[model samples]
Target: MKFLADNKRTLDALNNWVPNPIILSSFFWGAGNVDQRSIDGLLCSLLHQLLKAEPGLGPQLLTRYPEWTDRATYHDWSNKELETALFLAWDLPTRTASLSSLLPAAEAGIQGSMQTMHF
Candidate 1:
């Protein structure tokens, strides 16, 4: 939310950015398109990348929204949500589609970890 407030253009682009069509397709008839676990993992990996991209976002977010910054308040954000804000804080590189395109190491490492876990 802080990221949304701080960076309108990026948020708009993210909103307008068309998602990949295959992501909406189910493996079988009437089944979920993407499994929840895969979704969560992808989100987690993405957020981690976003935070790394914008190290200063967390501090600014906390400062602007102290209620959230204070744990006693509604600081119920999961790592994914927080990291998503960090990602949104970033300016999109020219013709950037996926961060993984620019940093293959991150995606490769994630795939390696998943394979090791057999998940």
Candidate 2:
């Protein structure tokens, strides 16, 4: 929930409880559109949010995938590429990025992604 992410008191408590203090969340609303509910879309949204929060990860990502260094073609992300990018973000040495996604229970595709992540 947004409250969990915005509440500073709770976040402070969580910071003491977890090694990696930063908490990020993404909410998925289908709005009756198939593309909006796909895993690729979720990855893109999550990656963008992650990059904004931790700009350091951007160079690491570029290091691994040199082709993406060019901003002109950065938007052309495939599903597999997005998944790989997320993995690379997670693999960063000092940064431990955590993401929570709110998915529609009825949307099987997104639900599958949650299951894959062991959520």
Candidate 3:
């Protein structure tokens, strides 16, 4: 997966063939880091990438969850919140292609997460 992500020619070809394509890629580790393999972590990482690609989504996210910008009251984001944010980013008109590589052991949890998101 990393190889595919690093291939500029392939990425360029994909973008050319797909209209307004936004490529999102993520890799999960299974080195006993629960957070890295959790749905919350996955959503957070994807949301970060999405926001970087489209700053327009930031305003909407802030509007939906204003406390996100307030460190004083900031808490670990719930999976629901993160999922909602990801959905919002995903619902945009632009086409998005997601490529995720996860360890076999973490498949169930990740699949459950996607199911909840109706992905």
Highest TM-score against the true fold, candidate? 3
Clashes of each: 0, 0, 0
Evaluated at residue 100, the lDDT of candidate 2 is 60
Candidate 2 segments whose C-alpha is farther than 4 A from its true place: 18-20, 32-36, 70-75, 94-99, 105-107
Q: Where does the lowest 10-residue lDDT sum fall in candidate 2?
A: 93-102
Each model's C-alpha lDDT? 0.38, 0.66, 0.72
TM values, all candidates: 0.31, 0.73, 0.77
Ranking according to TM-score, highest score first: 3, 2, 1
Of 1 and 2, the candidate ranking higher by lDDT: 2
Q: Which parts of model 3 have CA positions greater than 4 angstroms off?
A: 71-75, 115-119
Tell me the tens digit of each residue's lDDT in model 2 across 1-119: 66766778757777677655666666666574554566766677677777877899998899879987654643577667887887678667533435565665234656655565532
For model 1, residues 1-119, the per-residue Cα lDDT tens digits are: 32333454654565566432101110111233232224334544444444455456556655655655554422355544544443444333212233221123233334543342210
TM-score attained by model 2: 0.73
Per-residue lDDT tens digits for candidate 3, residues 1-119, read: 87876678657878887866677777777785766766667777788888888888888878877887763321366667777779987886556777777667464667867665533
RMSD each, Å: 15.2, 3.1, 2.9
Candidate 1 Cα misplacement greater than 4 A, ranges: 1-36, 67-87, 91-119
